[model samples]
Target: MEVCFVVGRNGAGKSQYLIDQAKGNNQDSLYLCNTVHDRSQELKTSKRFSVKNTGSHPNNVMKSVIKKMMREGTHRLHQIEKILLYCGYASHITVTMRAGKIDSRLDDFSDTSSIKKLTEMIDNYFNGEDEISFNVNFGETSDISSLSKLENLLHQEKPLRHYGMVKAIEISLYKNNGEPVPLLNASSGELSLMTSLIFVLGEISGTNMILIDEPENSLHPRWQREYTSMLCSLIEYHEVKVIIATHSPLIVTGAQLDERVSSSIYHPATGNLEFSSSTNIEELLWGQFEIISPKSRFLSEKLAEKLEELSAHKVSLNQSIEFIDSASKASFDDGQQDIFIAARQLADSIARG
Candidate 1:
């Protein structure tokens, strides 16, 4: 499997790159864009699934899973079950007061009929009923023993035990306090992660390429670090190539930490994507992505010059103090000002020594 990590700032043509690659690739491909809504129409591929359409509707996603299972066979049922457990599916109908009148909307996507069918299938298979069979021509035969083992593992992980409850006509995920949290009510990060994983794993097979834009969006720093490794593992399982475009340093560094995956940065100024050997986040920010703002860059250069002068003994202590004071006088925003202040203190200490 070929795994490529593309890191760059906004408007670095990351999305365009993925689009072009998907268009050019002769083999089957799946393009998942978190930023764009309903891009599947523009991309003109049934294999491509975006968060906008599919992520909002859990019933629709479950329906897709059932269809895939029918076509691909029951061997993948464990993966399907895992995704279903993680994805938030229950939604509550809500009402609002407007001008002394009531306005109500139904946010729930639960299809009782479909849920019943899915639950029946699961129950029959797990109960070791010989009447049910989900084998198809897609590939391997159904592995009930392996599926049983995975089901046990998933149960042990506590995600299923903690978050999910499966029923004959309904399945709902609850929060730690035992209140049900629907997908729509779930955090943006959680929704994105679950939806992306579902679509990717559901349609990964028989495809040579996968293009994902900004998978790190709305994810926590820890999740961002694990994002690349997770995708690489999935890609390897499917035996497909994947191109990921992201702005997160954690995502880039995470890929670097994984020896199995390859990482690169797209330099917008140079119009080239180059392999990055430097693991330093500072080097990545400045050299590869050019993420430093002009004002911050100016301040950084000024601080470096002042520190150099102090080290070389080319300026008096008083002069160095004056320089530092003048530099700090410049108005800077929160992070930039903090950096300038730290630089001033460091330079002051060096000059005094």
Candidate 2:
């Protein structure tokens, strides 16, 4: 369970790094990316799988299943049921809903037959006895040990509910008291955590390598701090190597704590990759990650210069205040405003002493 992290700014070839790693290990790699453009085209022999493409295709197998179901006449609910059946093998099974088509096709079922049928189909597909079973095998044959391992991994987290009868196959988290809430209703951090975990647990097995681009997307600082631990738990259960691309300092800090995890910082300007062991978020940000804004960096340098000059001379209180005020105003970046203000207060205190 080796975990290697790639940290860099946007356009630093982080995605390409994953692609290169995947290509090098072609036969056993799985790429899960969120980019709009298909990066899978670059993979000569590796496999690409994402939430969008998982079990979503009109292949011969699916077409045959749909054709057999459609022979029972044009019932919209029946069509949806067949699609779910085809996707049943996937861990993240879902049905696609087009409102215009639904309104047009099910117009005849005005007595709410459409709603009833849709509900019934969802219940049958997901709520049945075998629906929650982790018997799926991406390549290796399913075994009792593997199924138990997956089941235990899923159970360790909050149970997720399937919003199967709606627009698409959506997942919702269960509240402490066992009430299910929609994914939209959850906080951005919670959603990010759940989505990443599910994606890993659902696809990690049966693959030799897992590549994730920006696992920190939509995560809060606290959630970002926990991301690596969550990832490590999943990786521990499988014989897989994981590579992640991220810009989060929390993730870098998390990587520093684990000896099994390796961290690499990509410098876009120099086109170089360097190993990082810094646990301080500021060092990770300004040094390795280079995430500082130009405006902020300039203002910080100016403030430091002013402070050094003040320390060397007995500047008047009025002069010190004036310098601080001018520097504060010059620091136009919102993120650095607080730092400038703090520097001003410190300067004022020194002048008074």
Candidate 3:
């Protein structure tokens, strides 16, 4: 598995670069975006490519992939269980397939002993308050008998609505205490992580190339830090080249320098730059992110405007100095002392003039 981490500020052509790559090598390639403005939609003409619609619910794609795999007798129960567990949604997942509705029945109440045992069971069940049972159901919409037609529908943006011969995919997620977890109660980050994992480890497995844009969109900082490793562990066995575009420093540290390609770098040969984990985060911000100061952009812009106005004599030196002093003091933080000090020095020079 070869991973390329593309880092850059917003609108630096990161997503477009991925789109172009996918278009050029549309065959056996998968393009995914975790953004509403999915650029991969531009690749609609390329039928050989697997492109995800960021606007649609991720479950649509997940269900389709599960059906396709199920038809091939390759169950991803373990993989889905790992994804749910990693996202903190469940401790385990039980996948069951059935052609008809799934039903559960308690033993017939034949005697007093059986009734007493049932009462005890109910009491024990209620006692395990720490656990919950979550059910996720996937059923066929249309019963298409042909595998070729099933594959065609699975490739669509929404596969569940169309008719298919795929069996229902029922998964029950539970906690360590053996209680089910209501997967619908999961946070956006948990859902996003699970979706991305399923998308990668499911139908897109063994792909020639995988392009992911802004996978950190709904992920927490901790998940973002561990995201790269989790993804790699799932797909390391596959012969695939992965390209991830992100703005997170935590994600950047997940890959080595040779694996990182910055959009800010311009070279015909390569964009790889050494990104040592030993380097301080501040240097990463300054050099890689081009952040000159810890000050907010609003404050920096105001300071620049004040300096320009003072130089043009549009305001009194005392007024300008006082404004800069107050603004600097208001936005001051421990790490931004140097920025205020520089502003003060520039104000002093203007006052002396």
- Compare the candidates by lDDT and give the number of the best one: 1
Task: Write down the lDDT that model 3 would get.
Answer: 0.56
Candidate 3 per-residue lDDT, tens place, 1-353, comes to 46666665666677787877778884667776777667576776332222244323554545555656656643344456567667655534433322221112323424546445433532443243422222332222222333333333334312221122223434445665667644445577876787667767665654678878788888898888787778777776777777777777666554433233222322112455432333333345444554333435655666788888988888777877787666545432567667778987897797678
Per-model TM against the reference: 0.58, 0.49, 0.55
Off by over 4 Å in 2: 35-38, 44-173, 182-192, 237-239, 268-271, 279-282, 288-353
| lDDT per residue as tens, model 2, 132-155 | 333232222345453343333233
Highest TM-score, which number? 1
lDDT of each: 0.57, 0.51, 0.56
- The count of backbone overlaps in candidate 2 is 0
For the record, the alpha-carbon RMSD of candidate 1 to the native fold, in angstroms, is 12.0
Question: Which pairs of residues collide in model 1?
Answer: none
Quote the positional error of residue 148 for candidate 1 in Å.
17
Query: Which of the two, 1 or 3, has more TM-score?
Result: 1
